[model samples]
Target: MAPPVVPEAIARDYNEGAFVLDRSPRASAALARRCLEQVLEGYLSATGSDLKKQIDSVKEKVPENVYRGLHGLRTIGNFSVHLNKDTNTGQIVDVEPEEAEWTLEVLDLLFDFLFVAPARAQERIDGVNSKLKASGKPLIE
Candidate 1:
């Protein structure tokens, strides 16, 4: 049997974002935004909802702090996208490296909260239930 897998879309975007971080912060930020979007979409879908097509959906789906973090990620990415475009028109608005980097940091926290911690908790629950069944104890509800 195949091992269980966490979704890879966010991870892929994070990798690409990190890869471009030094050279083009704007591109990196864009990928970070993609990661955040995919994570939110996954959360919404897990709750039997369809994909969250708008940025505001994060606010609706998550707690305030998580929503804020996601919003921050989006804001940085938006700045990068808009500023880069402005550069083409002789308007140079810059996205610092730190701004792009912060998105990845926030993503790490979200991944743990949204994916890793839950998976671990579920595994622990399954193990406890298995032991209870083997011992003739009533399983947890």
Candidate 2:
């Protein structure tokens, strides 16, 4: 099932990222990072130019696991673009299969924290309220 997103653009990039994971981990990482940034900045109101700083603004706002995991993903996605690497072998730096899988896992964690668990919890709360109303009992506030 498609993960719930605040906007369609985020969903588009995220799904497209997952789609290209096997063929190109770099693109997958890029799109995943882009989607992450959008969710943080656009939805959560994180402020900053780069993902690192954007992440920084909201680090205290999210759970500890989300904060820790974001850094790992940023490293993987920004390696080729941001980090300084050895130029001796002239080898291209790209994301590995494990890294791509890990990024997806991180995305899952973030989505579950931000959207899924809350939605499910709300549904259960509403169900209880409905039962309470039918029984003429006090509803949970």
Candidate 3:
């Protein structure tokens, strides 16, 4: 089945980035970074400020695995961002395709963990609760 559309914008960015990975790794990395930022923003419920600060502030709140994934994405994407910066000579260095590919792979895992799995679990819980209510039975723990 297709994934639920919880965060549409982030999904769009991720899909577009994956689509263009081969032709433009730099672009792909940028989009993946934006996807990561959006996920962090929504997860932390803190925004409109420095992303690193927001992430740091939520260090204790986020699950260890999610935090690790976020840090990995940031580290890989930082190379893309730094290389994209214009030199004093007005030249931009592009990221290697491998870096962009890795970012996408991380995103795939994050999408399932951060969005899809929780949603599916909630759906299942709700379904069970609904059935219990209809049957005049206690809900499952």
TM match of model 2 to true structure: 0.87
User: Stretches of candidate 2 above 4 Å error?
Assistant: 4-7, 80-84, 87-90
Per-residue lDDT tens digits for candidate 3, residues 1-141, read 115544788878888898899998988888888888888777657554775666666667666776676676776677677755556766765678998888888777777776778888989999999999999999877
lDDT of 1 by residue, 4-122 (tens): 33376667778889999999988988888887767666665433243233546555655677667777887787777664446467767667899989888877767777777788988
- Top lDDT prediction, candidate number: 2
Greater lDDT among 2 and 3 belongs to 2
What lDDT is reached at residue 30 by model 3? 84
Q: What's each prediction's TM-score?
A: 0.75, 0.87, 0.75
Q: Where is model 1 poorest over a 10-residue stretch in terms of lDDT?
A: 44-53
Q: Please give the CA lDDT of all the candidate structures.
A: 0.72, 0.80, 0.76
TM-score of 3: 0.75
Residue-pair clashes per candidate, as listed?
Answer: 0, 0, 0
How close to the true structure is residue 91 of candidate 2, measured as C-alpha lDDT?
A: 64
**Residue pairs of candidate 1 with colliding backbone atoms:** none
Ranking by TM-score: 2, 3, 1
Misplaced by over 4 Å in model 1 are: 1-5, 45-53, 84-91
Q: The CA-based lDDT of model 1 is what?
A: 0.72
